[model samples]
Target: MMEMFDFRTNNSNGSVKRRLLWVEMESVFGDLPPSGISGSSHNSFTVEKSAITPQECENAVSLTHVGRAGEAQMVDVSPKESTKRIAIASCNVILGKKVFDLVLANQMAKGDVLSVAKIAGISGAKHTSTLIPLCHNITLSHVRVDLHLNPKNYSVDIEGEAASTGKTGVEMEAMTAVTIAGLTVYDMCKAASKDIQITNVRLESKTGGKSGQWSREE
Candidate 1:
C-alpha cells in the first residue's frame, strides 16, 4: 500500500519547498521513482512513512549482522543518524519472607545490599558492550538502578534505566544492569535463603532512533 509522507530534497543549489508525497517502500530500492527525483540538484530525499509492519521490516534486514560467507559480524551504524536513546528494564528477585525482611531492614552481611547492587548495576551498564559481543560501546549520559521491596509478593523489584546520545539504543545496557543487580542480590543474601529466584528480566520501554518509542503495557 502507498502511504503519504513528508519529503524534501536538500542540495547545494538550495532547499526545495517541503511537501507531502505518496511513496512506497519499493521506491527505496529504485523500483519506481516518484516525481521530482531526476534533476542534478536532487541530492537526497527523506521519506518519513512506510507501508510495512515493524516485524516485516526487521525480518527483511535480518541478515545485516551476517556476512555473505555466514560468519558473525557487527552491524555498521556509521551511516545512521545519532539521536538521544533511552531504555528501561526490570527484574524481580523473589527472596521469600525471611530474606525480604532482612533486606528491608538492611541487615545483609555484605554491607548495604541495595546500595551495592545499584553500583554493580551501573557498572554493568557501562560494560554492557563487553558482556555482549554484538553490542556497541556507546557513551552513556546517565544510568540509574532502583530497587523496591514489594511486600505483597515478598520480592525485590529492581529496575534499571539507561540513556545515551548515539547511533544505537541502550536496551541491552538496561537489561544487563538489572540482571547483574539481581545476581548480586542473590550473592549477598544466599546464606540467608537458598531458593532465591530472579524472574522477568526484560526491557520495559525504549525511545529514540528511527523506530521511535516503544513501551510494554502493564
Candidate 2:
C-alpha cells in the first residue's frame, strides 16, 4: 500500500493546517509498505492501488508453447503414455461449376483429380513433421483420405483421418493431410478455373490422448 504524508503549513490566523498527500511508500519511508494501519483518511483522499499479491502472481498461467524466458519451444511429450490416437480433419476445394464437372468426370488434364488428391493427402500426413517445424514426428499406423463431390456447392470435400500410437496427438497430421489434399484438387482444376479456393480447413474429431474424445459438435 502507498504511504499517506501530512505536510504542515501556517494559516493567515497563525493556525496550523495539514494536508494529506498520497505517495509511494519507498519515496517517503525508503522501505516496503508496513503491514499495519498507517493513518486515517483526510477530507480529500488520493487513493493509491496496491500491487498484486503473491498468491495472485503465483496463480497466473502462460502459454504451453512458450518457455520460461518467453521464447517459443516445442512441447515435451516424453513422459506421456503411448495410446491409440486418431484425428480427423476436413476441407473443401471450391471449384467453379465448369471445373467441377470436369473433375466429376475424371477428365482433368492432371489425371483423375480425386485419386491424385487422396494419394497426396496420405503422403502429406506422413511428412507432417517436416512441413510443421513444431509438430512431432509420429509413426502413423493408418491414414485414410476420402473425397466427395458436392453438387450443390460445386466443391470437392476432402477428409483425412490419421491414427497412431504415440505420445503426441495426430491432429496436426490430419490437418496437414486435408490441407495438402485440398491444394492438390485446386492445382488439378486451376487450368479450368483460376478462382478455385481451398476453404474451411479444420479438425473434425479426435480420440485418445489424456483428454479422451472430442468432436466439432462439442
Candidate 3:
C-alpha cells in the first residue's frame, strides 16, 4: 500500500507524455457534513438549503441506500493512486468570565479540564472511523491538539491536527477530534458556566495526495 509510482507514456508521434497519478479511496458518506441547517430568524428558510438539495450532498447520503437486502454499490476509486495525506481542523468555544476564571485557576470541579480534553482530542483523532460511520480506518502518524484562551471574551480556541500516509486525508478525523474535545471541555466546565458557545469548526490545512495542498485563507 505504501508503494509510490512514476510513469511516462509514449505517443504515436514519438513524443512522451508525462503525468502523475495518485490513488485515493474515500467514502462519500465520510465526506458529508454531519450537521444540518436549521432556519433562523435572521436567515430565510429555503428548500434549496436542505442537505438533499445539492446533487453532491444527495449523492453522498443516498448513494449507499440500495433497495435490495445485502445489496452493494461501491464507489469507483479505480482511477485513484496512493499518496501521503494530512489534515488539520479547528474550532472555538466562547466561555463566560466566571467559568474562564475557574478554568484558568484549575478550580473547576471536574479537575484538569484542559489536559483531559487534550488527551481526548488526540484519542478522538485515532478513533475517527468509529465515531464517524463510513470512514475508513487508517493508521495515523500524528495527532496534536492546542488550546488557547482569548482574554477579552474568555473564549478558547481548539485546534486539532491529524496526519497519515494513506489513500485519503484525515480532515474528518481532525474535525471530529476538535468537536469532541470542545464538547468534553464544556462538559467538564459546565458547572462553572453553562453559556459556552462552540463556534467555527473548520479544516485549516491539508497536504499530499492528488489534490495537492490547501490552507485556510487568512
lDDT of 1: 0.85
- Candidate 3 residue lDDT tens string, 106-194: 89888998899899899888888898666778789889998887788888889998888877768988998999899889999888767
TM-score of 2: 0.73
Off by over 4 Å in 3: 1-79
lDDT agreement with native, every candidate: 0.85, 0.83, 0.74
Show model 2 residue runs off by greater than 4 Å: 1-62
**Pairs clashing in candidate 3?**
22-81, 23-80, 23-81, 23-82
Q: On residues 95-169, what C-alpha lDDT tens digit does candidate 2 reach at each position?
A: 978998998888898899999999999999999999998888879999999999999999999999999998889
Give the per-residue lDDT digits (tens) of candidate 1, residues 1-218: 33322334344332222331222333333354554676745534554544766589767856766765456899999999999999999999999999999999989888788888889999999999999998899999999999988999999899999999999899999999999999999999999989999999999999999989999984
TM-score of each: 0.71, 0.73, 0.65
Best model number under TM-score? 2
Q: Among these predicted structures, which one has the highest lDDT?
A: 1
- C-alpha RMSD (angstroms) for model 2: 11.2
